[model samples]
Target: MRLLVSFLLAGLITDGEAQNWHGPHPWRANAVVDGRARDYNNEYFLHAFSYRHLIDRPSPIEEGIRGTAGSLTSDRLYMDFRYQQSFAFDDPDQAFTLDIQRAEDFDGSYDRQLVGFRQTLAQRWQLSLQGDVFSDKSLTDIYFGARRLHSEGSWLQLSLVLPNAYFNDKTDSQSELIDEPRTLFAQWHQQHTPWASTTLSVNHTPDATLDDRTQGDRVSSRQTRVALRYREQKGNWQLQTDLNGEHTRRQHQLDERPAPQAFRRDMASLTLAVRYWPHRWQPQVGARYFWLDEDGWFGREPNGNGEVSRQEPMLFGGMSLSLSDTQRLAPTVYLSRPRVEQTVNSPRWRDRDDHGFVGKLSVPWHITVSKQNGAVLSIVPSMRLHRFAFGGGNVQLHWPL
Candidate 1:
């Protein structure tokens, strides 16, 4: 019965995200808390710069651009980890896990080594850390926080972030400039009950560095900046808002180097999302509205109000099906806001506002194997189709023990 129990209890985890499919067990996921530690190694490069000291993200131009949720997204392979072992799994009070990863890109441009760790502290506190070392440089990330076993779901965490030293040196005067950025952040969240909850986060970067991810450029080289977020959830609905307030001189670097164009900007955003999932056959309906306010460039850009105020409401709906106790299929439809777009690179004329429509079908599968006690394999395959847009899809695979 121990082997059968282990096989049934071992839940599948992918990209560090886990869901408990079965009840509690002696050697199970509940032994450790939080999903970050479960998948820290894979998100090293594509991670956020918070108090946790996560890995420095790739250059803006190198990062993956996300579209509709659950649509075909980037297949960028994060560090591949081979799990080694766990300590004191039966006792939920004291549990720990370790993983080793190879640091490199999908094309195998660079090579490095990474190690991840997660440990429970004094029963309620959770600690997670990740480190990486290349041939010439090394980076470290550490996080300390605690959540409750109560229904309130109250929690607090603080993280310190340090960027890569290789990118810190600003030497290239002609092109390709760089700087090392550091940040400190704190977050507090409280769930009064299943019906209501609130989360707030504040992060400060001593040296302002506005990373222009779309163009992969450092628009703002140096300045003091602060970013924060506030979110409140009630029932199946939630409202999230965030702000980026910084006093800095941003520039548009063109071929002519004598004097680059510069501007000062500020921005804020509010988004409301609501979801309904009462029945399996009834299409789950979701909707989101975004209000963007900006000044610096002139319209509706993040750094400017270029005189254009852009507000686009989106429509999201999907049907979820339960194929089995451990398997499910979900298909969704989306309607994006209509907007007029101009050619940026070539600088052309003739424009029209166009709305977007997309559809997605995703299947998630789980398998159990009693290898060395228990192991779970997870696979997710998805397909998407778009009207007057590029169609795409992706597949994800993971085996967790």
Candidate 2:
């Protein structure tokens, strides 16, 4: 924990001019606790803390803390802290940012730390470099990413990540278990017309895997994804379409032998919406179509010779209304056909031929605490109801700085 704290503190110290001395520093804290009596028990608790200060005339320090505790059938606790300092260059468009984050569990158990730097290269280009280290674990990841924007509201970006995993020989059975995972990704966005915009992105993870025998001999897992999205706004109507394709390969080593398993998924969706605003009454109608294709791994094969494939389609709609300038309400309904039972661990498991509908409603109210200083606050309470799915309620608070 000391090493993690040191890494974060080192990034916070930089040369800067000290302006007006402020007593302590400005800070704000917020917390939310919500519970609902559904057929099944559910509850959530969240807390956040924020602080900001001027380190110098042209440098500022910012920090935040986030924690969550709750039970959705299982109880979990999480806490994270972050600090960053921003310094300005001679040019207004150019600046440098150093950031650090540390996170741990309630019992001071598992911990992780990240330190990074961000720089504005030019008018439309930016770069970031980060390293993540873990406590009680000998694994580290170094990531480099960059973003660039064109003049015509178009932009492109790319990222490269390298992961290095190490194991301690004293307590571990394997003398040295080292696994390296490398990843590359790229994306672009453009506006085709005044009312239309499109985004295309592709990701490739060629070497992401685990090579520890004690970890069940998972080896050589690769994944690729390609996605496209288009949105158009015309008059009081809006149309959107999204398409995505994903392919994954996993190999398991049994007795030092490798066996290949693969899975591919394809999805497409289209939505059309129309809004009519008349005085205090605002009504919106929406229709949607969704299609999914799951191919390859489905379930444990008898002889490991055949592949499983399935398809599904879905429809959805929603509407909303503005109660006043400071208050609004909205509700949405969705129906979808499930295909294949998907789990976090195995891609082969998926749901098949299931249809259900879910509804969500939200109402938000705004209040101005001070008119002279333009201080405002908003509160929103929302609920979700599903016939064949899980539902919950949430409350949100917002304040402008």
Candidate 3:
């Protein structure tokens, strides 16, 4: 369709800056700053950055205005919002939909928005186009998706995501830059019976490279992931299970370096949850297992070679009790022992083994807004403890628009 082609072309004008290093572990710049070394740690900063980059970091007030919490060198919290509306065109089946969303991470590092449009075709197929726009108004990525409806509660969907990039000027300071990577996503869902259903999904990102200006840091990576989910409900009881696995490979190089360093990572996790509902009270229990392995160079040669692995199994339980017709209180507790092993050949850093018991508690208040549309708002306050000592705590609010 001509409209679809125009949407795809719109993706090309997205702002694209050179991607940065994405090694498994944090990477320190070759140069030091103010008696300390500069480092790049995505997990902490929400993006890759070193000491020099801190100057450009947003202040707490700025973060708050954006509805994000947490900061570098501090704990993280997130606030997410979503709203959607649809309008019918000349034909009843031809509709234009607008979806707006904001999502951030616990640490306030990742923030994204979604702008979408959807159209119905043949009464069974739907075509959707969505753009991932950042707070700065720069387009990061776009998704084209098609869904085929087989019947109620059953469908098949496919999507392709293209990362946008552009060249400043071949001779200018900003040369070729690709801000993000391209990806392919697929999903299938089926409802065998009124009480049972299953879903499977796959996500793959082929090899992609980020080349900075004339000369700077460059990185390349490839990844694949698979996930399965199943749910069943009967007689006021609900059960759900989820399985996921992912593998990633990365190569990094400094400007004009002899060769790039290689890094590999593998992650797998499984979770099972069950809920029993009774009049005004509902109780739930869940178990989860998570594992990760990483081996690669984190920074410049001779200093970043290392291997790290972690495994954790956890159990959690919770219950919800209705306090009023539209209000309920839910409390949950979690317990886990995580073990991590790191082996590195470096002087400033030493190989070590760390394991500890971690516990967390959460109390959330839920209020129903629109019973017909199943809209609700939740306010959650949580606390954490490690080795019986107070670790940290956070409060989060979830509201649907």
Candidate 4:
């Protein structure tokens, strides 16, 4: 229902003694178009741009830029564009994408200036791709893979993505060692009940060299999750409970080492919340129990270290009140064990048993700026105070679209 163009530019100008004019110049822009075309027809478009400049004295600082644009047509035609600067060579950025498909048109456009296609026949499967070209090295990464949706509600999805590559000037000396990294991933999702869900995913990144010493090796990460939620709603009182468990594993090489390091972590949490909503005010109280276990080498320690575990309990309470139709106020309080942890061999391990309290409050005012443009803006001011934290402050901002 709204088409908005947003732009942001930020840069840091430093004045050091020797490098008097040095810092990073960063800028970003985003454009979003959303509206309904006709009955039951929706269209949307999004564009984003980001640029960063690194400045040095004797030599000019490197400049890098990235841009992306995507749109969903009224007739289900989806298109995307992506480009990134190559700081090593003064070359224009590249762009690519997968072409739109119709029921009968499979061999569509392969225009060199605007689009191209590639087909690969692997031992087990076939892959088809098409995309536009901006420069020689940069191309849009696209792929499609699907799996069966079984009768028991289990579904699987497999996909391969070949993203664009940008030359890193810092590691240009070792460019030969760094290869372009590609990602392969598979995910499975299942719904066992109305209040329960499970997901399993695995992601693999092939060896991509950034430098000779850091010849990136194939890394694989896997995650499995199960969550259960229960809610009871009666009149003005509500009760809810959510429980979840997750396990993750990551394996990767470091510093051209042949042996790969593996890390595994497990986490489980349970939260119980109760709320009462009246005509003008709503109050909620919640408590959570969390447990975490981590094992294996984190690449810092040469010899593999044993596992570590932590348990924490947290309590939270919040309330919201509506002063009028266009104004609201909310405040929340949280108490949790300190996040600092001590290793078994550390000398000050006893200092990890502390607790802290955090309090936050927010108020929002909705104002109608224009009637013809249907413009409405909400301004919110928030503040956070932590008893034992390092920084505390208040924030005020108008919500941007």
lDDT of 3 by residue, 18-77 (tens): 011110111111210011122212122211111001010111101111112222335433
Candidate 1, 23-109: lDDT as tens digits: 000110110111011111111211210001001111010111111112212543333222233455566654554333322211121
Global Cα lDDT for candidate 3: 0.51
Candidate ranking under lDDT, highest first, comes to: 3, 2, 4, 1
Q: In candidate 4, residue 363 scores what lDDT?
A: 38
TM-score of each: 0.49, 0.56, 0.70, 0.42
Model 1: lDDT of residue 49: 9
Clashes of each: 14, 7, 3, 4
Q: What C-alpha lDDT values do all the predictions have?
A: 0.33, 0.39, 0.51, 0.35
lDDT for position 211 in model 3: 62
RMSD of each: 12.7, 14.0, 11.3, 18.7
Clashing pairs in 3: 46-109, 76-106, 77-106
Give me candidate 2's TM-score against the actual structure.
Answer: 0.56
Off by over 4 Å in 1: 1-130, 138-153, 165-180, 194-197, 208-249, 252-256, 263-283, 290-311, 343-390, 396-401
Error of model 3, residue 116, in angstroms: 4.0
The order of the candidates by TM-score, greatest first, is: 3, 2, 1, 4
* Better model by TM-score: candidate 2 vs candidate 4: 2
Worst 10 residues of 1 by lDDT: 50-59
User: Candidate 3, residue 330: CA error in Å?
Assistant: 1.5
Residue 1 displacement (Å), model 4: 19
